[model samples]
Target: MKKNNNKLLGVVATVVMAIVSLIALFPIISIVLSSFIPSGSLMRNGISFSFPWDELTLSNYTYIFTQSAEYWTWYGNSLWISALMIVLSLFFSSMVGYALAMYDFKGSNIFFVAVVFILMVPFEILMLPLFRLMMDMMLIDTYLGVILPGIVAPVAVFFFRQYALGLPKELMDAARIDGSTEYGIFFKIMLPLMGPSLAAMAILQGLGSWNNFLWPLLVLRSNDMFTLPLGLATLLTPYGNNYDVLIAGSVMTIIPIVILFIFFQRYFISGLTVGGVKG
Candidate 1:
């Protein structure tokens, strides 16, 4: 009787989870189906899951590929910025985090506290001063302007620092005894161990950089310099709304992030778990 009850509970739990999964996936499914229909139909209906299958068309994709030149440019700009942010942020933030975690330096605790304090402060509070600094440095309207401020993210630093604390220090001692330079010890012996943290941050920072609009809007002057999110916003104006390009382009924007998450998903969960546990 107990065995039968246990089996029944398991079946019920599976059914409940399946229903929850479908509920979560509803919005994504709706957007994908909406992308197939005409933009006019979409604008009129406001994204319906019950639309007739025959009403679907491929013209939205065709327009984005053929007619939308600016769309490609925006896509490229976003891709470049996101890639640079992930690489540079990981390289510098990891080094700082590892040093804070492993080495007993003067003001190390002070630096960590500062990082936590800065993390608590909102980005909006810093934007005005950062904007002025960018202007003073003559980096406005450039990719450097967009990428510089975010290169050493506080959250990434904190995450890395926390994760690095869990790394075995005996490896560092052994590497030192083997006559490895400090950089060699970190790059060769330590970095490989932080793979999960790196993958996790790459996905997170990539997503943030790709979707960022306000900062880019403040710094970038020319339409050519605009990132994907900024470019997509311009499609809706007082004169007209390019719902066709908007919806299609929006769907395309999800592709890179989805790919990033899929590739790094194995590490992402483990990274977050371990990183959080130490601190």
Candidate 2:
């Protein structure tokens, strides 16, 4: 009886998970399928069960890569911005996390609380003010304008702090005993050991920077400086439609993030888990 019940439960769990997986995959499947459909067919018949899968074409992708110089330019811009954001966020967040984790000083609790407060504060609330500040500093329309703001996200600092908390204090103490300077210990010892956390932070920050649309849209007026998301938006004209190109652009935007996740999935999961556990 016990063995039969266990088998039944496993079957039920498998069915449930299978259903959930399909539910999660439905939208992605729909997008990829839609991207290959001819623009004329898509207009004649909206995405439906009867939509002809046999008449798939690769023109959307070809047009995006070859015909659209703007798409490639924007893709390059997004990559550079994301790279800069990841580097800066990792450095600043790790240093801040180390300080919060290792230092013992007055108002430490207050400082931690402030970091938490930043997590609670919505970006929408700061958007206008930050834009104004950027205008004053003449950062508007510059790559630095977009890249600088995301370099020290509260979430990044919070994740770093959580992972840092798990580090053994004896290592730092030993480094100090060896007469290693504080900077030396941080760069040489602490940073190396914090790879998992940093990798995790990099993925998060990179995704955020890459997908950042609103801020970049607000700050960047020049076509040359537009990121992937913003440039893709331009592919859709105000009065008319370009479904094929639009879908192609969307696919282009998703490819990098999907590749990043595939490569660093382990670190991403570990970092997220550690952050959740600590927080």
Task: Please tell me which predicted candidate would have the highest TM-score against the true structure.
Answer: 2
When summed lDDT is taken over every stretch of 10 residues in candidate 1, the lowest stretch is: 270-279
Write down the RMSD of all candidates, one decimal each. 2.4, 2.1
- 1-279: candidate 1 lDDT, tens digit per residue: 999999999999999999999999888778878888888887776766578688989999999899999889999999999999999999999999899999999998888788778778888999999999999999999999999988978778878888899999999999999999999999998999998789888877877798999999999989888999999899876443687788889889986567756887776565445446545
- Candidate 2's residue-wise lDDT over 65-148, tens digit each? 778787778879988888888998889888988888888979989998987777788889999999999999999999989888
TM-score, cand. 1 vs. native: 0.89
* lDDT of the candidates, in the order given: 0.86, 0.82
Error of 1 at 119 (Å): 1.7
